[model samples]
Target chain A: MVNILANPARFLRLAGAVLPWCWAAAAVTGGVGLWLAVFVSPADYQQGDSVRIMYIHVPAAWMALAAYTLVAVFSAVALVWKHPLAHIVAGAAVPLGAGFTAICLVTGMLWGKTSWGTWWVWDARLTSVLVLFFLYLGLIALRGAFDDAERGNRAAALLALVGFVNIPIIKFSVDWWATLHQPASVLRIGGPAIHPSMLWPLLTMAVAFMAYFAALLILSVRAEIAGRKLQALLVAAGRNEPAADGLQGEAR
Target chain B: MTAAVTEFFRMGGYGAYVWPAFAFAALVLGGMAWRVLARLRASEGALDRMRDRAEGGRP
Candidate 1:
C-alpha cells in the first residue's frame, strides 16, 4: 500500500476519495462530541463545570503531539526513502499541529486559571509543551527560509527530526518532575483513572479531533500538491513567453 | 426555559473560563478549516486558469 501510494497520482486519487468521508466524520462526530461534553456528561465533583474544558483541551493536546509525531515520521521517511509525498505531508501538517498546540496551551491556561489559581506556570509538562509549540513555529520558519523550495523542505525535515526529542519529554515531564499539571489519567499504565461518565465524552472528543485533523490534513496536502503544479506550470510558461513580452521577461 | 438556558451558559459560575476555552477551540479549529479550504480553492482555480491558458496559447 505504501509503495502504491508513493505514486503522486494514485495518492491524489485515494485522498480525493477519502476526503469527503473524513469531512463527514468530522462534522458528525464533532457535533455529537460537543453535545456529550456540554450536556450529557456529569460535572466533576470538585472541579465543577470547569472540567468541561478537558473535552477540548485534552483532545487538542493529543492531536498536537500526534500531528508533530506525524511530521517527524514522514520527515524521516522523506529524508531516508526520498518519498515525494512525505515532504509535502510533513510541511502541510505543520500549521495544523501548530494550531492544535495553540488551542491546547490557551485552553490549558484557562483551565489552569480556574483550577491552579494562576495563568502561567513553568512546570515540567507545561514548559515542555511550550517548547513543542516553539518547535512547530521553527519548522514553519525553516521551511520558508530558503530560495530553493526543495532545500527549504530538506532543512525543515532535518529540524523536524531533531525537534522530535521534545515529544517524549512532553509526555514524561509530568511524571518525572513535581508539577501542577496532573499526570496521565486516560493514557496510563494500568488503565484510565477517569470515571466512565467523563471517559466516554473524552474519548468521543478525541475521535472528533482526529477526524477533524485528518480532514484538514488531506485538504492541506491537496493544496500543497496544487501549488506545486501551479509553480511548475508558471516556470514552464516563463520559459515559453520571454520573446513575446520583454517587460514580463525582465521581471522573470 | 430561558432560566435553564442561562444557567447552562453560566456553567456554575466558571462560565468565563469554560466558555472561552470551548469558544477558542472552535475559533482556532474553524478558522484553520476556512483557511485550508480557501487555499485549496485558490490553488485549484489557479491551476485551472493556467491549464486553460496553456491550451489556448498552444492550440
Candidate 2:
C-alpha cells in the first residue's frame, strides 16, 4: 500500500480516475447547498438575511484551515519519508489555500460589519487567520525563489511544516481568547449548537467545499506532474536524444 | 410570481452584502479552476509538440 501510493505514476493515474467523480460531487453538493441556504432555510430572527453569508463564510473558513493542515501533512511526508508526490501536493495547494482563506476573511468582514458594525478588528481569531493567509503567500514565494527544484521543494516543505503551528492557533483562537467572533457552534466537544434547519445547509456546503478541494487538488497535482515531466523532457533534449517516452498520454 | 421573485432578489434587504459574498466565493473558486485548466492545457500542448518533433515531426 505504501509503495503503491509512493510512486508518482500510480498517484497520477489515481488522480485522473478520481477527477471526474470529484467534479460531479462538487457540482451537485454546491448547487443543492446554495439552494438550501438561500431559499429553503429560514432567516435568523435577529441577524436577518445577513446570516445568509454563513453558508459561504463557514465553509470557506473550514477549508482555509483544512487546506493548511493538508499542506502540513504533505510537507511532513516529503521531508520525513521523501514521498515523491508530497512536495508537489504541498506546492500546488498553496494558491488554492490562499484563495479559500481570502474568501473566509472577506466574507467574515462582510458579516462582521453587518453584525458588529466593524469591518476590521485586531481580535486573535481574525489576526491568526490573516497570518495563515500570509503564511501561504510566503511558501509560494519561497518555492519560486530557488533555481534548483530540490532545494526549492525542500525550503517550501520546511516552511510549510514550521508554519503549521498557526493552524492550531487559528482553530482554538476563539476559545483561548475572548474575541468578537463566535466560538464552537458546530465542531465542538458537544454536538452542534445550531438548529437543524441551519446545520443541514452548512454541512452540505462543507461537503461541497471538500469536494471542490478534492477536485482542484487532483487537477493541480496533475498539472504539477505534467510540469515535471515537461522539465525532464527538456533536460533530456539537452543530451541530443529523444524524450518522447515521458510525453506519451501526458497531454490527457 | 413577481413578488416572490422580487423578495428573493431583495434577500431581505441584505442584498448588497449577501450578493457580493456569494460573488466573491464564485470568483475565487472559478478563477482557480480556470487557472488550473490553463496550466494543464499548456503543459499538454508543449509535451505534444515536443513529442512530435522527436518523432521526426511526423503527423
* Model 2 Cα lDDT, one tens digit per residue, A1-252: 545548888887888898899989999999999999999988998899899999999999999889999999888888888887888888888899999999999999998988899998999999999999999999999999999888999999999999999988988999999999989789998899888999999999999999999998988888888888898888767876656554544332
Q: Write the per-residue lDDT of candidate 2 for residues B36-57, one digit (tens) a residue.
A: 9999899877877777765664
What is candidate 1's TM-score for chain B alone? Answer: 0.81
Q: Could you tell me how far off, in angstroms, the CA of residue A50 lies in candidate 2 after the best superposition? A: 0.8
Which of the numbered candidates is closest to the native, going by highest lDDT?
A: 1
The residue ranges of model 2 lying beyond 4 angstroms of the native Cα positions read A244-252, B56-59
TM-score for candidate 1: 0.94
Q: Model 1's CAPRI class?
A: medium
Give per-residue CA lDDT, model 1, range A1-252, as digits (tens). Answer: 456437877888898899899888888888888999999999899899999999999999999999999999999989988888999999989999999999999999999999999999999999999999999999999999999988999999999999999999999998898999999999899999999999998998999899889989988999988888777667767777432323133323
lDDT of each: 0.90, 0.89
Q: List the residue pairs that clash in candidate 1.
A: none
> What ranges in model 1 sit over 4 Å off?
A241-252, B56-59
